[model samples]
Target: MGLISEVLLLPLAPVRGSAWAIRQALREAERLYYDPAAVRTELARLEEQLEAGEITEEEFDQREDELLDRLEEALRRRGATGEGTAL
Candidate 1:
């Protein structure tokens, strides 16, 4: 049965492979986006930019809020998944 199914589905191999690749890419992207260390690094860079006058206070506030939110979400996700305590 397995051999017969594989033979029948051989024509769809390319589609299946593409779908798998897409899924893997998405997973990797999500991992990086939700990484706590990466979020913190971005936050630090944002602070540096503010201190250097590269960004206005308003802009800094807005971007800082977004980064904090991402950090909160990452921690929450880690807690939910029992990945250990927050950093």
Candidate 2:
């Protein structure tokens, strides 16, 4: 006697391309904003360093200006529309 068995199987679609495409999309997003939290935190720390005498006032001012400019530009590019005050 022969017995027949049947099983329900789900099809697996290709997700390799999806993963790459997602990564590419994320890279594009990051290129615009990159990381606002980290940038802001570092900028605050630079200010603190100046306050604590770790960095000279002139050095602190220069670095802070550079970081602020970059952050504002990135924010504007990300559609924050110059109102990127916080969060």
Candidate 3:
């Protein structure tokens, strides 16, 4: 099964995180959605967690999806920045 598909086989997961990591990941993910390197890093981490049974595949998938979605939104936001407009 795929990552998302495998995630669907499990019950809802509960995760705990530091506020710092959450904010940092969110910021990084915005520009990193389609970046293969970023995706690979996250995927490797998720895969390791799953392999260790620290997190289920479903949890990994959900997190991955969230990151991707955030990235897409970020790109849209970035695109909306018109030419040479100072923020």
The estimated TM-scores of all candidates read 0.90, 0.54, 0.39
Q: What C-alpha lDDT do the candidate models reach, one value each?
A: 0.93, 0.72, 0.65
Residue 77 of model 2, lDDT score:
58
Q: Per-residue error at 5 for model 2, in Å? A: 44
Instruction: Tell me the alpha-carbon RMSD of every candidate.
Output: 1.3, 9.5, 19.1
Better candidate by lDDT, 2 or 3:
2
lDDT digits (tens) for residues 23-86 of candidate 2:
9999877774546676788898998898899999889989999889877776665576554555
lDDT (Cα, tens digit) per residue for candidate 3, span 25-50: 99886556645456557767877888
Which residue pairs in candidate 2 have backbone atoms (N, alpha carbon, C) closer than 3 angstroms, thus clashing? none
Could you give candidate 1's per-residue lDDT for residues 27-58 as a string of tens digits? 99988998999999999999999999999999
- Where is model 3 more than 4 Å wrong at Cα? 1-44, 82-87
> Which sections of candidate 1 miss by over 4 Å?
none
Clashing pairs in 1: none
Please give the TM-score that candidate 1 achieves against the real structure.
Answer: 0.90
Order the candidates by TM-score, highest first — what do you get? 1, 2, 3
Model 1 / residue 72 / CA error / Å: 1.0
